[model samples]
Target: MRMFWGAAALVMVAGCQAAKPADPAVEKAWVRLPAVQGNPGAAFLTIRAGNKPLTLLSVSAPFATRTELHESMAADHGSSSGAGGHMMTMAPVKQIDVPAGETVKLAPGGKHVMLYDVAPGVQPGAKVPLTLVFADGSRMETQAITLAAGDAAPE
Candidate 1:
């Protein structure tokens, strides 16, 4: 009887150690890019996960050699105009918080991913598939369509 109890305890510990982490559930995602002409760069949509905290490991797209996370900022102090004033700039964000029943959006002048050096001749109406990996070894895929240059984002 003692031997049986000891064996069972060891098995339970082993099982716990071998258990795999669960994947986070993605709620919604989107992206933004100029339509008329493809630029050297592009911005991606924010992601919102349902009821779980997950770390974003990396992002990839076939259209570009490398995809980097970036943020855009509007200079508030006339920095662009050569005033040398403090610019209201937005920098790249490392992580995002996804609260339960709420969504975290990566919008213009905010937290977003930057797609650099796109494939030659990428045009509007093209769909780009992006794969996002999480820290728990789970992945999510999203497709973003190209928008026309000067086109306003949908409200």
Candidate 2:
């Protein structure tokens, strides 16, 4: 009867609806190649948040002895006039926030993940595994390809 047709229509409509996408997280992660061993390196990535805001807790890499989230800031050299060379320094940060439905980019000369004391064996054309820990106790694993020191960022 009419009730049976109504139920069939409802089921058809439900079946036609597309499934929702998976949770958003990190994407397009890459690590800049280091000039030499035992030197610092930088990592860049974009964090896409889901319904709730995401906080980057920490970063870990196999090539580096220690890895930490860091931000670069311009230093004030006690110069009232803007006539001196700008000095930049990097400092450790507890967490980086990625607002809901937004992407936070970690790039060179800006906020980035700092890798200290990189191993000598880690060379160009190598694949470095990076684990990004979030505040929600979720972790995303990605691979960063090591490029030449003079090479540009991956497209």
Candidate 3:
């Protein structure tokens, strides 16, 4: 009986180790205020998926009533405004996939989160609370620094 119990305990420990997932991290989170008052805002950040694939479901913030995952893609090459007749367009994305052991950046003029009806207090130098929801039903709560219209992102 003692030998059977030991064997079962060893198997349980091994199974626990095998079931562990990689650690995920969010860094350099910052919010960019709108250029004009009462307009919408945006947020940028870097997501690191360590040794496991991840899907970013949505972003929510206390300052904005509506937040969404969005992407900027090139469209309508017929227009000739230079740059090889390429025009930028914003599209709503349901989710953003981050591969295993990779880093995805949400930067200016690229993939980012759109914030609507932002509050007045979410100004430069302010720390706004942000919640990142993942497809695995995991939520990460972090604070994002606010940047002015012309301010640069964090290093």
Candidate 4:
């Protein structure tokens, strides 16, 4: 009888341990809206990683003539005392890393997607399909709703 009770307790403890939930990581990602028909447009997305680092490989959109990952950097002030800052353009982002247990934010004056020569016929209030590729060979597709033209840079 003593052995039987001990075995039962062990089995109950094992069951409780197995009921733990999975880590909520890299499952929820949000991409901000992209600019349209205003010279150059930008796309912003949010990435979450928990206990595992993630890489953003590439992005594709239907309405853009060309899409590329890009980042904006403030130009070096002539004497580090200039009031108006200049922007120093750099190459597109080929790979991005998202640290574990944090959210990577893509915003204006930071990391963003640059769309050159947006395709015609893409109108406001329309949603464009965006496919994001990951380093693990997994892809996630989401619809990025369009905003009115000349909305300016994204946050």
- Please tell me which predicted candidate would have the highest TM-score against the true structure: 3
lDDT of 2 by residue, 40-142 (tens): 8888888888767889899988788888899998887756655675777788999999987778999877899988887777777788889998889989888
TM-score on alpha carbons, each prediction:
0.64, 0.78, 0.78, 0.67
What 10-residue stretch in candidate 3 is worst by lDDT?
76-85
Instruction: Score residue 16 of candidate 2 by CA lDDT.
Output: 67
Best of the candidates, lDDT:
3
lDDT, residue 148, candidate 2: 67
- Distance from true position, residue 91, model 4, in Å? 3.0
In what order do the candidates fall by lDDT, top score first? 3, 2, 4, 1
* Segments of candidate 1 deviating more than 4 angstroms: 1-39, 73-88
| Model 1 per-residue lDDT tens digits across residues 54-81 | 6676677787777666666767665666
lDDT of 3 by residue, 1-109 (tens): 9999999999999999877876889988999999987888999998989777889999989889899999998787667676677778899999999999788999877
Clashing pairs in 2: none
Runs of candidate 2 with Cα error greater than 4 angstroms are 1-22, 76-84
The alpha-carbon deviation from the true structure for residue 56 of candidate 2, after best TM-score superposition, in angstroms, is: 0.8
lDDT of each: 0.64, 0.83, 0.89, 0.67
Q: Lowest-scoring 10 consecutive residues by lDDT in candidate 1?
A: 27-36
